[model samples]
Target: MASFQKDFKIWVMDHLPGSALLSEPLSLEPIAGDAGFRSYFRLNTQIPLLAVYSPPQEENNLAFVRVSHHFSSGKIKVPKIFAVNFEKGFMLLQDFGTELLQPLLNLDTLPQYYDLAEELLLDLQLLHPGDSIFPNYGKPQLIAELQLFQKWFVDKLLMLDLSQRDLSILDDLFELLIGNAMEQPIVIVHRDYHSRNLIVHNNQIGVIDYQDAVVGPITYDLVSLLKDCYLSWPEEIVRQRALSYKSRAVSKGLMREIKDQKFMKWFDWMGLQRHIKVMGIFARLSIRDNKESYLSELPRVVNYVLSTTFNYSELKPFNQWFSERICVCLPRYPWYSGD
Candidate 1:
């Protein structure tokens, strides 16, 4: 009897021309939602479809539809939008089934799955829009994301008191991260291209949660997939896969042949930025949105940032601060793991 749900159902019903298939009294079972305010429900129609309620004020209903059309035409596997009402923030899309790409990932299955993922990613990057609607991932956006880490994770979550020197150090690191992102070969980036956001249906990897896609550094999406926030992989295996994608990108003329170390630096730095942003985002989700489960995943993100910082000399200052300030205090939390 909720207003939005009732209005959404009415809109979805109008879009489906075959009203004769109304034997089933419209039942809308809840589907798992993401970090956004969007809600999804599985419709019991003869052909399974999803009814989504993405709030117009909070979510970009128009952008999702536009990106979906753009990506579908670009040969990427994405949900086919059946009908949409932007004003009401309602959409009926092809149901990609219950199988998520997350649970199916493992060492034995990773090579094959990652290959598929990388292939789709390459297809996505091949799209170079001349006057596209997708925004550029410029310094302003990157800086805003980095500030979330400092504001939420460092200040609110950890209750850390940063002196003038500490604040200056963070400001310097943010600038470096922003520069790292801006200097790469620009391409379409699915900002959250990870296992959880991907769908496995009919033995194919279908992309989802790509509404936030933007034109950014080529290494952005690759790092998002390889150094996933939810899971960890051996360094050697992750490196091998990362390099393999670089090779493929070169072969496809997405980028010219580059040194493995150079590509690795971009990939690593990009991940560091993303994980740093996530620290702030995860904290915001916990404190502002009341999603406490997000805090459990911070340990994996910490491991990723530390792994690269310890290897690279430029990040030494950050490594020292994280080790002395952040890492030392993490052990007190139940989810903290040094390993």
Candidate 2:
């Protein structure tokens, strides 16, 4: 504890001159984060502070810093960066207390929160196609992420030992899915925009864990919020809300050319792709990283993939395969039972 205090105190002092004096640095606690990264805490401050210590060697520290700055400038509510040391891979950020959208989202507050999310989506789509600041989420990357599902979840995690023929079929299905996603209107995508990544502070939603922001389909983040893996809503209700959001976006001239049906297809296809990627990520976190908490969310992720794939005639083959093979082999988790 003392050693961690010394290192954290020194780190804060070096980056933020007066931060150490805020309070005596306390022991580090592990904070729950997405599958891609790990984070630790440094509390014991009068301001009830926490510092995210993501190692530079393990993750893209520079991208996090840059994206945070870009989004902050764009009026997105991300935690303000107080200080940063790129070479050392450390940053001091304003602590947005633990008021996550997941725990705070109830029936009464759902509509209001969804409205705020819609506004954010409008702002996100305002980003142009050729934005140099964000990474591209084209066909190749989408296919690659889907393949991770095939490799990790189906093959390694489930120990399915799929034959070459089965593997080839899955690969072809993934290619089709990626092609569908690439055909949609592209925008800046907050790759993991969901209830868990949203912090509700002072009656406002602040986004976090957006270091992996990319230039992707406009519907990507929308579906991530509506078909959230951690929480489930009725399909009809989600669709109605999605259409409402689309109407607002069109009125705001963010998506001027696309019709309602075309936009719906974009939402469904992007969701299918994201759910596939998330399943693989969750499986990897459990089997490889020894994190079991995400395992409970697996069934919901699978449901999103199954539901979206069943929407189109072209995806019938993929849909049938999931029902016969995947769904039968893996029963739904308890959390997915109620809704």
Candidate 3:
């Protein structure tokens, strides 16, 4: 047996001795991975399970386990961790299946699935973080994320040399975005709540890749869900869905009665903060990790930036910078066409 495979088997036997998996032969097949460093495989044994091999150096397996436990305790629909070997960075989990919510999404199915998603989100929001440790997504962290767009996307990927004026405008824009985010109601944030990280199983929505959950602006996850990085919905539909969620949230006392305009502003600005960070992250993933497919999603994210920024007079300067400096150069790259 290969040393790595042998090590995985040994760890499983030691950690999961009484499980039914040991009663039969084990077979594993590779499954598609996420943006993170962890790799997954299906354990085709008498009892179906998933074998996750997270590189100890790159992934925080312990935090994943702890968060899984916390979510499970709160009745959140997250995959169950059957066993884990933190030292080896190996874990056995309940197989949620191959049905990511992204592929099933369309105009027809959008409302149904999104309604369920919002319900799940509200459950997470209402749950008290009594003993669970979640990182604070505060001003410093928010500002740092905004910087990713300038550092990785602009400087590294686009190779743009910004003049002093451009740099000053970007800094001002970052602070504006940070202020918008910090002004919202804070709650549990599932940092990546988009369709791809959601699993549609047995007529229920199961969430994954939640290790980066945080206490942040309540609108953060809502924006991540409705104005997704991987898909787009009509502006009217997005606004309606967001309003519906706000009504429910207010009824449940999860959110105070804020003006619809204020809520939408929060959602839009929060999306810009997220999309800006994503541009930097996607570029870094392609350049540093050789995950080139992430580059293809850049144009959609850029469009989100422009569409949101164009509406606000305060963001006109940044919008002009994008139109003058970035959008014109986009056609040169195969991944972006300024659509």
lDDT of 1 by residue, 1-339 (tens): 488668877888888746326676887889889999999999888877889988899998888888888888887889988888888788888888888788999999998888888888998999865366698899999999999998999899989998898888788888878888887888998999999988887777899998889999999999999999999899999899999899989999988888999899989999999999999999999999999889999999999989988999989898898899899988887756524
Assess the local accuracy of residue 119 in candidate 3 as a C-alpha lDDT between 0 and 100: 93
**Which ranges of candidate 3 are over 4 A from the true structure?**
13-24
* lDDT of candidate 2 at residue 222, scale 0 to 100: 90
Off by over 4 Å in 1: 17-22, 337-339
- lDDT of all predictions, in order shown? 0.88, 0.77, 0.88
- Cα-based TM-score, every candidate: 0.96, 0.90, 0.96
lDDT of 3 by residue, 1-339 (tens): 499988887676565535545555666688899999988888766655788899889998877888888889999999988888778789988888999989999999998899889999999999786565788899999888888888889999999999999999889989899999888888888899999999888898999999888899989999999989899999999999999899999998888999999899999999999998999999999989999899999888999999999998889999999899988988999888534
TM-score, candidate 1, is: 0.96
Residue 170, candidate 2: alpha-carbon lDDT: 84
Predicted candidate 2 versus true structure: per-residue lDDT over 175-195, tens digit per residue = 777777878766788888999
Q: What is the lDDT of residue 47 in candidate 1?
A: 76
Superposition error at 294 for model 3 (Å): 0.6
Q: For candidate 1, give the lDDT of residue 299.
A: 91
